[model samples]
Target: MRNPISGAISTLAARPLVRSALTVVTALSAVLFADALLSAPPAAAQQGFGNFFSYQAPKPRRTAKKKRQVDPAATQRAEPGKAGEAKKAEKSGPTQPVSIIVSLGDQHASIYDANGFVTRTRVSSGQAGHRTPSGVFSIIGKSRWHRSNIYSGAPMPYMQRITWSGVALHAGVVPGYPASHGCIRLPAGFAPQLFGMTRMGARVVVSPSDVQPVEFSHPLLPTPKMQEVQVPQETATQTAQQASVELASADVSPDKTAATETKLLNPIAFASVLKKRAVAEKAAASAAEKAALQAAQTAGAEARQATTDLDKAEANLKAAEAKAADPAPVPSAKVQPASQAPTDTGATPSPEEVAAQAEVAQAKAALEQARATKAEKSAAAFAAVEAYKLAAARAEEAGNLIDEAERRSEQVSVLISRKEGRIFIRQAWKPVWEAPITIRDPERPIGTHIYSAVEPSADGSKMRWTAITMPAAKASTSSSRDRKKSKTAEASQAAVAPPETASGALDRIELPDDARQRISELLWTGGSLIVTDEPRSPEMSENATDFIVLTR
Candidate 1:
């Protein structure tokens, strides 16, 4: 209020200072309001995203458990109770040791037991041409009633069947030799006892010879003087004394006694005996010499006859060879030209008629050309026939060689039968108990047998590793089971880890390639994936994983 200019300057300064202070306070208040707004909870957080921004600590995770695997070998073993039952069944029977001997030579059967020989009976064997085989056999089965198809309504008595086929030993009239059509015929009366003595699975040996005779060469004839020796008769008391003496001397060598006896014999009588023997020997030698000479003459005559027959045979062979080598040649006819001049001199043709005749000649020339063409075709057909015959002969020769090779490589089939858990091997349809182990395939079908080398699966769960599709009619119950088992095994093998390579996997499997190809051809008429060399899509390529390649 003192000076106006100074007051105004002071006022301006004061006003500026006040304005600056007010700005500071307003900026501070705005900053405080912004902080409060940022601190408030989000609306989205209340709707279940609270943990998205929040930092709550995570709870510990629970551990997972692993599954256990089952053992296959332990599962395959038979149960204990069943095994005990099987053992008990095996021990419950009183086994009878019965035997039957059939002689192929006599065509008869003889039954025997521990007691002694049961009975001897007549029998009929195979036949004249189909002779019953000579070998050891065992009774495979027994039946009360049996009949023969080949024989006229003949009822087999005490029918003890030996083979699976109709072959058996039963009551009938024994032909004394091979007469029946493979059945061993027995005498009607002895049938009951024979049947009673034999068991279902008794051993039967049908051999060529039952008893073999001992043989020795005859000694030289005794001398007449040695044969004539006689001792004087003695009283019983004296004989007893002599016998005692002989018994005491019996310990001495027999050679010494023989020498003494020869010495005691009269030399004159011995000489006479030797002379007679020499005469007889001379006569015998002379007769043998004459007989030998006659035999030589007869042999010479036979040789001459044989030579004549051989010459005739050679002539016949030569004729046949010539016929085979050179076939008869066909005769051909020659064509002759028609006569130019007419035989009828009175008839003369006009110009028009002569023109017509000329045209006819031209037509005949054309027909001759056609005939030549036909002749050429006939010749070609004949040549084709000759070629076919030659080819057929070659094919026949190849077939014969194949047949001979197969015959040479023929092996006997080893059949195995498993009844009540026991195994048996058979050769030539006859059972062999002591058969070689190498010939037997333990993993083959339980009832059937085979001789070929059958390669089982690598794991041995299936009988054959390779797939063999047999005809439906020929399939047995066991074979059907085997096929099912093979399929299951194949599925199991497929379930295993995929093979290292596609080809390697194919090798482990069996597929009918030919049949599959045929089916593919039928479905895709024009072509197939196997035949085409085109690239496939991923889906199409996946099909290769399932494809299998089988080799013979």
Candidate 2:
């Protein structure tokens, strides 16, 4: 204040010192702040932060406890019910003897009993015209009065018919094997003995070949047949009436019993004993009605299936017919030759024969061409169908993604605008600076700009700047140098690239010496370096080579 000039100089000098001191303080404060920031624990370091508050200790693994042993007597007493069940099973075990072996090949049969076994005589099978069908067939029905269509229409002696459709094992001439039309013909006078050995529901195994022979030590004693044990006709009829009454009363109600018994008995009598049983005709009519109903249902199903298949076939046939209708160009030589062929003949060929020959030739060629075209079209159709399937799958996937995106968009609360200025800024005085931006959610801070434009909104909510043009100044030069350097670096990196092998090339090819020498000789002799053979890996022989390499 005393001397203004001196005071100004002194203040100016002190200003520099004060500024230096302040700079040091700021630097130190910055260092200390950075240190503090770096040294502090992470924000997520709190104990029991991640699922720890509600955490439960793992349960201890349980060890299997050894089972306590019980006494045999205690176990037996504990399950008294099982003892009764075992005794019942023992009582019911295999009461009747089952058949042991049945040979379809050797035409022999055997039966087993609790005491021993019994063998039967050989039998002939179905002849060549009607071979016996080999299969595991069960005895579904039996008839004692079985007859044959072949063998002089003779009544099968001692017949025990097994199959329902007329095949049976009966007394007939056994000419070694498979001599009868289709019947399992047994040896003469042996059918009765075979029948005696078999039960009503016994299993009969017919194998493709005969098994090892089995000897029977114990033979069954024959039972005598009752010759004079007939009752009076009236008594017999009364007994049958009583039996039918008992059958009618048991389980089935009287009306249902009458219906069922009538149904069973009528089929046999309707065809054979119609005069004897007039009432049975009504039962046969009911069966006939049921059969008609079944046949109609089956026919309807078949017709529906046939219609569907016919529709598809007709479509294919139309396509083929259309292709066949298109005329193919014939060569001039082929036409001339065909015309000459008729002239060369001494007599003029008949129009029919000429037409027939042409038809045959045309048909053969058309058939071949059709087959080829069909194969190609089939392949193309298969590929097209697969492509369609793939496209459909992709479209479905994209649709699902779009649906998910739309659902997510519904949950977001944000206003979106599509106006030009909402994304870019434009200026009047300067060249246009075009920048485009996408706002995923308008609620969040705007992300990086995509492209710039020149117009700005009226309210200054959006700006339009001129197209950015770099000034031809020091900055431009520096950027160009940097780009050149980057290019050079890229070129250098590319120059040091590893050598690539050809797709099917090999090194140190293994080939037979003879093949190698032959190939060399051929090449030396000015022959084309072609070797025709199948290709093999690891080693190439003369027989394995398959290509030509030509050189000038």
Candidate 3:
């Protein structure tokens, strides 16, 4: 026995339309409670009418866990393993200079904070004709809400642009398969988290496989110079020997001061050679250009002469044709004398008239010869013009090479090879010296590393360098289980420590005394240092220094 008013209210709530309206409102409220990637609100905040209608998707065997749903009415729950990861993330705190690694083979992506690995998740990359380009890149642009300009304005939520030509990572429906048109499709839930963790200039390395950093030790690691040994002398003979030395008559050694002076002057001498070479190249290019131009002019003159000849031939052919059609009258005996009896004026053509026909035939033959000559001359003219263009192109190339070589000669540069793992220095196009250097993790992929020494004080001592590390496709990610027990304990300390930067004094390099002294002496400002996995190219070594090499 319920009250009539209560019964009426219950009836209204049971209606489909009323329930649907309430569900929409309930879902909107749930969204308001959860906005961050790593956080969630209280359960009480989400207690609403939306749960009355639960929608579940068909689950795959391997992925028995629920898929991320875009349904607004659904309760946004974190994955089972996510809580532990979130706790780990909280302990690590925010990462600076973040880096992301995407693997095509695994269909996965990982985030590396300034400290170390943060999180990893699955992703869907390009499909079919739109294969994702694998390389090292930086996030150049961001859009919280964006639409594809190239794809019928399809919505791309939390878009992070990596390239100018429409390649990006964005929130979209991932069907556990390659399906996007070139862009990387991220999980609807994970995209928001990643978007929060990254900013412009954050590195994004896409590879065919997973790659991780490993610990490495080499001769380059900073270590104190070895100390000289001494033995205690207990005898007077030993003491006397140490105190005095016998002077030998043949103690004279060749003086190297002049050779050193000459070696120093070699740069000036080479500069003159380079200058002369440039002048000679310029002269050769000019000569080639002039020759081509002269040939073209000669061709043009020949062509003009041929054209005039053709015109004259055409006129001669016309005249011959007219004469053949109606020949000139020959003087007849009828005009000379009426008494000489009737002379035939109109009769079969005589031998002289036949000769006129032969002359007409000869004129036609000459006209045809002229036309053939004109065609040959026209072809020659076209060839000459092409030759001129080729010569001009050669001239321009020569000039550009000259300028580039001169500039490179003046600039200080370095070549680093992963194969050798050594740094080679060049100043004014001459090899100054070389030294061994250790990569932090030599076992893992070091990639191509470039360090550009920017804005230096007159001396190279007080200078800064910018670094870019692009790992190769074959690089691999190291496992934490592989690290030693002691290293694992140190990980916590390393996480809290500041990172080693590319610029400033490198405390890592352990050098021989002579090598260390040599490094200090050579810092003439405005130079660059390049390191790569690939060996230096012959052309580059011959002409000028080439920067960046991440291949093979």
Best by lDDT: 3
Candidates, ranked, lDDT: 3, 1, 2
lDDT (tens digit, per residue) of candidate 2 on 1-552: 154434544655666564676775665555444444333444323221222223333345699988964322321121234444323322443223333244544455544333223333456666546644332222333456656655566888766544445656677777655666566766555565455555543334343343321221111101111111223344334435652211111122123223222221111111122221222333454455555555555555555555555555555555555545553433354454554665554776555555555655555565555555555555555555555555455545544444432222111101112232121111111111223333233242221111111122332122222111111111123354664554221111111111211111111112333433322211110011101111111221222121111100
What is the per-residue lDDT of model 3 for residues 1-552, given as tens digits with 9 covering 90 to 100? 444444554655666764677775665444433322113223322432222233223333485678855531121222355555544664554445466777665576777654456677667888657877765555767999999999999999999987667889999877665678888888887788788888664657665555543322223222211111121222223323431211111111113342211111112223333444566677898899999999999998999999999999889878877777777777666454568766678878866568778878988898899999999999999999999999998888878667644553343556656567777766554566777766545544334544443333332124444444443343323444542332221121111111333331133333456654443343322344544555654323332322323232
Give each prediction's root-mean-square deviation over alpha carbons. Answer: 40.8, 51.3, 23.3
User: What local distance difference test score does each model get?
Assistant: 0.38, 0.36, 0.56
* Total backbone collisions, model 2: 29
lDDT string for model 1 (1-552, tens) is 254434544655565565677775665555444433334355432332223234333344687866854322221222344444323322442123445666554445554433224444556676645545443345555666766655676787678765444567877766454566667776565566566665544556554433211111111101111212222222223323542211112122123233322112122222333343344445555555555555555555555555555555555555544554454544548644557544676776555555555555554554555455445544554555555555455545544444432222221111112221222222222322322112123333221111111221222221111111110112123444564554221111112121122222222222233433322111110011110001111211121111111100
What's the C-alpha lDDT at position 294 in model 2?
58
TM-score of each: 0.23, 0.21, 0.32
Which residue runs of candidate 2 sit more than 4 Å off their true CA positions? 1-95, 114-116, 149-152, 212-552
Ranking by TM-score: 3, 1, 2
Instruction: Determine which window of 10 residues in candidate 1 has minimal summed lDDT.
Output: 524-533
